[model samples]
Target: MARLSGLFLCGALLSFACQDLGIAVEVKVPAEPLSTPVGKNAELPCSYSTSVGDSFALEWSFVPPGKPLSASHPILYFTNGRVYPTGSQAKRASLLQNPPTRGVATLKLIDAHPSDTGTYLCQVNNPPDFYTNGLGLINLTVLVPPSSPLCSKSGQTSVGGSAALKCSSSQGAPRPVYNWVRLGSSPTPSPGSMVQDEVSGQLILTNLSLTYSGTYRCVATNQMGSASCELTLSVTDPSKGRVAGALIGVLLGVLLLSVAAFCLIRFQKDRRKRPKETYGGSDIREDAIAPGISEHTSMRPDSSKGLLEKPSSASSVTTTKSKLPMVV
Candidate 1:
């Protein structure tokens, strides 16, 4: 009975030892995130430890940022001892390890874009060696340099007023940070006078004074690079501007009034120079009398000659009448 018990204990111990030695495959990747500039190549390191078999397979996949791991798409695959790049990344991606069955399944991606910023999954599979999880995850960031910022200003910047200046860059992957600087010698001109919003890239000036007027620059910076733009601020006296505007308005009003008066005066002078046409009864009577007086003067000369010749006829008639009365 003692010999039988000793054999049973040995068998039990040997079985437990064999079970412990049957651990499964495990995968490892970099713990820290990887970063690279846009249009550059990025390497995703991956490794695994297991009893590799003749039918080993490795797969590389990607999931965009803010997406679930299950949504990842295959980037490359290794089967039959050959690497096959798949999906949109096929032309730009390749295996770093030639065989990939040696537990190294690193991937090299060329010409990465800003849209490639996401998590990458490396999976290894070998039948009968899958006791453990055979997966690894790596986070990648693709950096884009900032383009030149567009600077703008709003609100009244005159003395004793407020003004807001804004700056922005549209072409940056991770949103660019902004910094505003006034190009002058006065450092910290007034505490709390200038306020800045880092995220929105807005600078506000309160109780604006002439000292705040100068060349201002806005700089946008990101992990990749920086860009900047400049603008000049000119402070004017509000009273002077209003006075000048009032003067211009007054001059324009005077000019319009002068033009109207000149037109009216020219119309009056033209009316005075034109001759008036008369069509009254007195004008017609005067025209008729002028011809009648001319006719009477011409007939008076003939009447006087007739009167002088009528005296001879009157004497002959009186002598004949006296001879008739004596014969009776």
Candidate 2:
């Protein structure tokens, strides 16, 4: 039993000596996630506690959202007291800690895009300091401002009916949230006769009335910025609408009838002014010859004998034989 006790004591001393000779390397980063608006710079904080040696290396790598760590690629590297940036992030990324030999390994990224949102790994390698973990993780989020929203109506919205007004914005990071307001009204629109959908950005107005006619505004907001759009709603009395339509139709019919009558009258006048055509005939004149004496005077015997006698010239006389007239 004494020999076993002596062996356990020696083993404990050896374990303690090994512990004293071991070098610890630990990496630390912020516990909270980091965020920045698009087109801005982001600084990833990283620090380490290690028994570093002359042969030390620091590496910064990125793993895109939803990707495995094995798929991560190097963003920058530090070795031999020199910094080397790599991949697409070479021009935009740099070491915040110059000579990064004093346990500082922060990285600065400029002009961050939405695609830059992901996980970053900071790893430190000191040859003789390998007992403790030497890696840190950082999560970054990139924000994009909302674009102008589109507003539209989906129903007739007449009196005693229903309608739906919708608003949407397609461009924004973190998905934009939407709100609606009735123009010229309070900031929080009264929800007395309408149903609002916060998720879909739709408003349903039930049993609509003329009082609902006005301008409506839609606002979309995200972490970065906001945008708005406005639309007008007009309501007309159904009875007045029908009366106006009837009057318009009657006036149009009257106009059509007047045009048809004018066209007929013009056609008849043109026909009357045109020359008439004659077929297969020559023209005869009534004044070509003079009329003879009256029949009663011609029947008298004395008138007949005078007509038979020829007139004598001043130098010569001519005689003609006469025939007696028979009474029948």
Candidate 3:
């Protein structure tokens, strides 16, 4: 009986070790970019290919951009047939072992942020000297608000014209959503074409015209927040051919107005600087002749000071007119 009991104990310990330290050290995850944003949850899944009912250990860790991996930075760890994680990670990370009958371990991240973007590795351990390599790598990227959308037009040989526009964004933690709206008209009843490119988040529009012209808007939304770009379109009319004439007329009017305003201002400034003297007044006439001379006589050294010095008797003489005075 004692031997049987000892055998059972040993088996139990073995099972526990397999469930804890002896997990497949390597896991398989997709090798692609993970789209995430701040204040949201993200998932990094890993699975192991092993016999059913086999026990193993799984660990998930995130290494900084340039840092190497180690047990100290483990986000989640499965050991001693139980799960353990850092306090910070424990609150946000979860594990799965249901298919533990097979070897499947996955970690879910909650309240993600841009700083969370990094390289993540999933490891499995099966003990005593058995370890395996991770199946793939998961690369992550963060996205920023999208840039303003651009609208363009195309001319058809038979048709008048068509309008096209594309919206694009970049540098975000998670993928962003795009929405377009036309101004001054009812929303489009038919679904418009929009595609996310493999290389960028820009959306493209093809075959647009005056009808398509209006206010164009591109809105980008993520877990963190949202942003938008708006533009007003001036539709093109193929039938309008006198645009140059209209532009010329406007330019001419503006030029004439500017000239009139300038002349008026100059006249006011000159008027302010000149004195307010009336024309043809005695003062004005005297001032005008002051520069030439005043009607005063120069005195000789012996001239008398009073009127008694005047000549005693004046001989009066009258001259006959050379010609008869003309009568008006």
Prediction 1 global C-alpha lDDT = 0.84
* Global Cα RMSD, each model: 11.1, 10.6, 15.8
What TM-score does model 1 achieve against the real structure? 0.66
Tens-digit lDDT track of model 2 for 199-311: 68898887777888899999999888899999987755798889999999999999999999999999999999999887544555543322442222222235745754433
Model 3: how far residue 121 lies from native, Å: 0.7
> Considering summed lDDT, which 10 consecutive residues are worst modelled in model 2?
292-301
Clashes of 2: 0
Candidate 3, residue 252: lDDT: 100
Error of 2 at 315 (Å): 54
Candidate 3 stretches with Cα past 4 Å from truth are: 1-26, 31-40, 49-57, 64-72, 98-102, 134-136, 140-226, 229-328
Question: Which tens-of-lDDT digit does each residue in 198-235 have in candidate 3?
Answer: 33334444444445545667666666566676665555
Q: Which wins on TM-score, candidate 1 or candidate 2?
A: 1
lDDT leaderboard ranking:
1, 2, 3
